[model samples]
Target chain A: MLIKKGAEADIYLEPFRNVLHGAGQGKVMVKQRISKRYRIPEMDRQLRVSRTMLEAKLFSDAKRAGVPTPLVYEVDREDTRIVMEFIRGRQVKLILDSLNPGLRRKLCRLIGRYVARLHRAGIVHGDLTTSNMIFTDEGRIYFVDFGLGGYDSSIEARGVDLHLLRRALQSIHFRITDDAYRAVLSGYRREFGKGAGEVIKRAEEIGRRGRYIQKEARACR
Target chain B: MLCLGIEGTAHTFGIGIADSKGKILANVSRVYVPEQGGIHPREAARFHAVNARRVLDEALNVAGIELEDIDLVAFSQGPGLGPVLRTAATAARALAARLGIPIVGVNHCIAHIEIGRLTGRIHDPVTLYVSGGNTQIIAFDAGRYRIFGETLDIPVGNCLDVFAREAGLSHPGGPNVERLARRGRRYIQLPYAVKGMDMSFSGLMTEAVRRYRDGAHLPDVCFSLQETAFAALVEVTERALAHTEKKEVMLTGGVASNMRLRTMLELMADEHRVKFFVPPSEFCRDCGANIAWTGLLAYLHGVRQRLDDTEVRQRWRTDEVDVPWRGK
Candidate 1:
């Protein structure tokens, strides 16, 4: 079944079976990068193939770092598709208002910890947003969609990653942003230890740089 | 009420007269086009200072109204070059003080959207504002215009212009590049940089220049550059539209005059099944009318700035200003 048609990719739900082993079977999500008609066909295919392969690698890297993510089952570079374990849950963005205050805080804290772990493993979720998170019935939060993610250990990259999340919170969950983000930072510090402080500091610096650019741009105008 | 608006934010100095009933009586503008390079701040300000009176007089003549008949004065207060903004603000203050009319300072970026909304008759749209110095995807959320995405480095227009100049094309490379791109049949590979909702164009610009220097066909290089940059823009815009679930998409800013960019945005809007709007080419570029129209809204909503507060802000963010005219 067709799930969602995003700007860069189209997602579908399908049942997958291990034909070689004839043993394991489950539902999977097939995320196919859609070819943009405006792009050259060869260049488009190259981008799709590389991005698909990178996403599959990042998923495993993030999972190994203690972040809950959908398991990658197969990567088809030729078709620019990834068949991954289908996550069954509600998007956190849709359920944030419905969740109890304590649960919401706990979920955000866990998300912070997960993000911290990913960063510690040199994985940056480039498109970090509440919409990219899923809350399963089992009370676990799963980070999904690593299409824009990559392995980057630079402090700047990590800061930008967190900055993206902060902006997302400000935009999507403005009501509980302060409390939720505070919990997130605390949880990140607890999980990542001393390194968390540096990343948090860097994130603030990045934010200041953005403000500075705004000011400079205005001044130069 | 008759409101006179002054706009001298960048390369243009304009004066517009509008009434409370949404009638634009006159809109006159004089642009300072640099002979060989990008705008120089002091030069632009000098141009504004020299032409401000002439433009204002032309607007008054076109409107057939005396200065004493104006009920209010509005001017673009920020997000521009310091000298240029100061000149316009000084002009606005002098006019208001002389006439003893209420004066308001408006955000130039928000004014662009408000005028587009006013003229296009669009309500609550995800706005893609692309210009030489600014590129942002904005939508009214919560209480203000929230920026969804923006250029991380150089703006789309600047990217095109810089590349065009490096390739020996004239200033304002957007039109010339577009003209050349029409004849290009192939798309050379160019960097496509989109991080989340934000995009980066400096890399694309650099790569385009490198390819041009390496003997790649000029038309093909231009084609690819535009394709890559515009795709990143469309991707971010499309994401914002989905995330906000807005019912309409509006394209405004100087770059909105580009036919290819408009076509790309329109296609995305059609796919999302939302109304698409772009003001006429004249309004798409900077002008006094937008500032005037937006200022009228602000004044009607009881927004007024003290003379002391009339000092221009070099970096006025669109979200920093409150939109009392837009009710939550």
Candidate 2:
């Protein structure tokens, strides 16, 4: 069944036995990158195939780095699809604004821990939004959608990732973003150690640059 | 009552006259064309200051009103070149002080969206504002226009203009690039940088210029540039529309004049089952009418600026402004 349709892909849920060897009514997700008719055909195919492969690799690498990501089962680059373990959880985006303040802070911290781990592993979740995160029944956060991310340890890249997260919270969770994001930063510091400071500083810098804030400061009448 | 608005935010100096009845009496603009390169802020400001009298006279002449007949004065107050902003602000303040009328300092970006709403006669919309200085997907939320997505590095129009200048194209690069893109047959690969709701075009612009210098076909380069840039823009707009669940999609700014962008946005809006709107080409670019209209809305809602308080805000974000005129 087509469960979710994202910008560049459509996700389907299939019985575990259909893709894996054994079955106990478990379900696996089959994410297929859809070809965008708006793009040049050859370029479109190239982007989809490459992004599919890149996402799979990033997921695997992140999971190995002590972050909670859905386990990858199979990859089909030719068809631009990936069959992964299904995450049975609610999207944080839909529930974050309603959760109790304490629980929300805890969840935000957990999100930060996973993000710091990913950054430590030289990976950046390019599109780090609440929508891309799932809060499992196990009280853990699973980060998904590495389509826009890459293996970059540079502070600038990592900072840009954090900036994306900050911006997402501001726009989507405007009312409660300030306190939640502060907790997220605390969690990041708790996990990433001293390396977290420079990254966070850079993230602030990136945020100002993105808003053209510095330009105004310099060009003030 | 008549409102005279002056707009000198970038390369253009425009004057618009309007009334409380949502009728634009006159819209006149004189654009500054650079001799060899991009706009020089000082030069642009000088141009506005020098032609301020002439444009004001022309606007009043077009509106068929005398100077003392104007009751309100409005100007694009920020998010633009500092010197250019000051020139426009000074002009508006002078006119208002002499006429003993209230003056409004308008946000240039918000003016674009308001003008679209005024011209299209739509209530609320998920707006894609693409101009030389901005690329933002804006929607009204919480009594203000919130930016759902925007360009991270450089705006889409600037991306096109810089590439055009690099390739030795015309002064304003968007239309010229669009004209050449129609002749291209091949598609060259360009960096597609859509990261969540935000996009980056500096890398794409850099790469396109490099390819053209590397002996790539100009038409092919232009085609690929527009494809990557516009596709990224449209994707973000679609994402914002879906996220916000807005029933209408509007495109504005100078770049809105490009048919390719208009068509892409129209198709996306159709796919999303939302009403699509773009004002006539004249209203798309930077102008005084948008400022005049937005100013009127704010003034009617008790937004007033004294001479001492009419300071321009170069970094005034769209979300910072209170839209008392827009009901919750």
Highest DockQ model number: 2
Position B106, candidate 2: lDDT: 92
lDDT of 1 at B243: 85
Tens-digit per-residue lDDT, A41-160, candidate 1: 776687788899999999999999999899988888878898888999999999986789998888888988998899889899999999999999998999888989988898888888
lDDT of each: 0.86, 0.88
Model 2 lDDT tens row, B1-328: 6787889888899999889988999999999987877777888899989998888889889899899888899999988888899899988888887778899999999999888888887889999999888888999987779998988888888899989999999877889999999998899988999877899999999999999999999999999999889989888888888778889999998898888888888877876678999988888889999899989999999997778999988778888888899986
Give the CAPRI rating of model 2: medium
**Model 1: colliding residue pairs:** A218-B314, A219-B314, A220-B81, A221-B80, A221-B81
TM-scores, one per candidate:
0.94, 0.95
Lowest summed lDDT across 10 adjacent residues in model 1 chain B is found at: B264-273
